[model samples]
Target: MMQPILTVAEVNGYIEEVFPEVQGQYLCEHIAPMEARVRAVVGPQNLRPGGTVSGPTMFGLADCGFYMVLLAMIGKQALAVTTNASIDFMRKPEPCDMIAEARILKLGRVLAVGDVLMYSEGSDKPVARASMTYSIPPAR
Candidate 1:
């Protein structure tokens, strides 16, 4: 397995620099080899009418988690963007913090494929799953 090029702190700093709006919402927890873990700080704004975490909130966590994994492997290339994504909402998430565990299944020079599983904090079962593909920018 390939080692990560960036540390958790570096990835978090890069995200804060480029996406200040989401600075405290998403946090990179850990990164190693082809995997990354991220946490989403869920607040009232992330809840739906039923007091359950909204689908969009889970989706955002998955996307951010996968991005962290990619950045950890490839360094801070801000231009890398999601090309495709599919998500399944497996269960209703509690109105609390959420964690996303992302893994890279395939990585190439120009594209990477990965998946993320999201769970409410302290839960063993995933509430959602997302598969994503990202387009990597050409080397300068």
Candidate 2:
């Protein structure tokens, strides 16, 4: 079995240090072989005019989920950047916390591809789904 390059606590700590703006709101919950679980607590600022969770908030959760999976498999490569992303808003989310489950479809030397499903906490149906590709920077 392949070992994880980073632990959940490590990834969460890194995000807190590097992206302090999202501290306490977003967190990396778990890391498995090629999968990651992240959560984003719905705050007042994350609500849209219609009182639903904003689309950008869902997108951010998806992106962060995918990034966490990549980092879990490849270590802390902060320079790794998104190359492409597509998101589908399937359902309106509640004003509760959101969870994103990410699965890495492919992990190559130079690139990674993954998909994410976002759900309102305790809900079975997904609120959004996203596919993303990231460009892994060359090692120095």
Candidate 3:
């Protein structure tokens, strides 16, 4: 059976209950019908000068996206911590919203890794790429 993905409503509830700031920064969307992966989008408030999305904006989205994904798969656990993050800014994103697609690369007892590709909304090219490592606390 395929794993279930978190719905936009569920994501919002999570934000309201734990990560309130994420609700305004990112919107969880259903990108594909078959894969059930989540796509997080950033709104205008996250923009920087020159009409491009800022690095910290993308990082926040990436970080929050991982947290959402992990909660979708393993259930909400607020203690998960971001242990490592390496991102490359390839190009300036267009003057619009930013999108990030995150998928888990590995999930073990203590660590979870995921890759995030960031792009400017309405653009076909990627603006950045990031890999994040999250440390999931041991089960109680």
Off by over 4 Å in 3: 31-45
- Per-candidate Cα lDDT values, in order, are 0.96, 0.91, 0.71
Cα RMSD (angstroms) for every candidate in the order listed: 0.5, 1.0, 2.8
Judge candidate 1 against the unseen true structure and give its global Cα lDDT, from 0 to 1: 0.96
Residue pairs whose backbone atoms clash in candidate 1: none
Maximum-lDDT candidate: 1
Q: How would you encode candidate 2's per-residue C-alpha lDDT over 1-140 as one tens digit per residue?
A: 56678999999888887778888877889899999889998889999988899999998999889998898899888899999999999999999899999999989999999899999999999999999999999999
- Runs of candidate 2 with Cα error greater than 4 angstroms are none
Residue 101 local lDDT, model 2: 95
- Residue 21's lDDT in candidate 3: 61
How many pairs of residues collide in each model?
Answer: 0, 0, 0
Give the best candidate by TM-score.
1
**Candidate 1 lDDT, tens digit per residue, 1-140?**
79999999999999999999998999999998999999999999999999999998998999999999999999989999999999999998999999999999999999999999999999999999999999999999
lDDT of 3 by residue, 22-112 (tens): 5556666742311123445556766787777777877877777667677666666788899999999999877667777777777778998
